[model samples]
Target: MYRKYFKRLIDIILSGMGLIVLSWLFLILIIAIKVTSPGPILFKQKRIGKDRQNFQIYKFRSMRIDTPDVPTHLLENPDQWITSIGKILRKSSLDELPQLINIFKGDMSIIGPRPALWSQNNLADERDKYGANTILPGLTGLAQISGRDELSILTKSKLDGKYVENITFLGDFKLFFGTFVSVLSADGVAEGANKKNSNEKK
Candidate 1:
């Protein structure tokens, strides 16, 4: 009952409140990003959402307009494309704040697996096999706080499946708090994106 109803209700309420409360911060970052980088303020990319559907996940633009379509791990020099402000935004996870819109739009939730990149066929397939794709993607999740970019795609898929099996108000609370701690500590955020998944093409 909670998964089908209350969860989405919570998503809408919290995300709506969050946008209202964070509007000032959003404006500030908008100005900062524009001044520091010559490009759009929001970076939109296709990601696999619930049921293998595609949706545009949003982030504050942290890279150059001409940044390649590949994941950061695939980029030969991700840092070169990152702007001066992007560095701070990424380190602070401010780059992801815009995803509150995704949650509000019903494309994501406050807790679930991070949406897979559109090109992440292996990740999506693994999640689908485990039925993890049945749930909305999230702003943060168990795997995110546990290891973020450190864990392998398969490992992440397993953890994501586990989360689906164990979804509960308490579990979600734990993940939410854990994510807060992780963000504050900047834990598990692989800046160089060195982790490799088998599905990635060289």
Candidate 2:
């Protein structure tokens, strides 16, 4: 009942309130991005959402205008494309604040599997086997707090499947709060090209 109905209700209410309350911070970040980078303030990318639907996910632009559209892990040297303010935004997870708009618009939930990139065929295929793609994507979820950028696509998809298997108000509550702790400590964040390099080494 909660998953089919009340969860979305909570997403709407909380995301709406968040947009209003965080407007000031949004403006500040907008100015910061403008001052530091010469590109669009918001970076929109096609991501796989509910039932593998395509949707544009929004984030604060953290890379230079010329940065490639490929995933950061695919880049040979991602740090070269990241701006100074972008680094802080990525680490603090403030870059994802715009996703509240996604949540409000029903493209996402406050907690669910993080959306797969349109180009991430391997991850998408893995998730299909677990039925994780049947639900809306999220601003953060089990895979996010568990390892963020550190986990392999298979492991991440499995965790996402686990989350789908046990969607509940209490579970969402814990994941939501747990996200804060993960952000503060910058847990499991593998910066850009390093992630790729590490995997190659492994």
Candidate 3:
């Protein structure tokens, strides 16, 4: 019941309210990104979603237009492509605020597995093995709170599987708020590369 109905209901209510309340912040980020970088304010890319569906995930642009379309985790020197403001946004995770729109659009939920990139075939295949790709992708999830950029892809996929098995109304709410707490403390964000790369995709 929760997965099929209540989840989307809550997502609509919360995401709609979030966008309304954060309208001012959205405008600020838009202008800030525009002035700091010479590119589109929003980054969009093909990400594998529920049931192996492909969708464009939206995020605030924090990289230069010339930045390569590769995961920051694999980049040799991600800092070179990041703008000054992008650094703060990446650390603070303000770079993800634009994803509220994705939640509202039904391409994502407030909490679930983070969408893997289409190029991340290995990760996607792992998710399939764990049955983690059977539901909508999310803005945050167990893997995100567990270790985020620090977790190995295999471990992250395992956590996503665990989250799927444990999905519930109350459980989702807890994880949703836990993500905010993680962000506040700047915990489990980065490992080898800058944390902002997670949202800088596309």
Winning model by lDDT: 2
Name the regions of candidate 2 deviating beyond 4 angstroms: 197-202
> Candidate 2, residues 1-202: lDDT per residue as tens digits?
9999999999999999999999999999999999997889998888899999999998998888887767787787788988999999988989999999999999999999988888777888999999999999999999888987788888988999999999999999999999999999999887556585122100
Better of 2 and 3 by lDDT: 2
TM-score of each: 0.94, 0.95, 0.92
As for candidate 1, its clashing pairs are none
Q: For residues 49-115, what per-residue lDDT tens digits would candidate 3 score against the true structure?
A: 8899899888887788898767766666877888888888888889888888899999999998889
Best by TM-score: 2
lDDT of 1 by residue, 36-119 (tens): 878799988888999999998889998888887677777766789889999898888899999999999999999999988888
Higher-ranked by lDDT: 1 or 3: 1
* The 10-residue segment with the lowest total lDDT in model 2: 193-202
Model 3, residue 128: C-alpha shift (Å)? 1.1
How many backbone collisions does model 2 have? 0
Off by over 4 Å in 3: 191-202
Please, what is the whole-model Cα lDDT of each candidate in the order they appear? Answer: 0.86, 0.88, 0.83
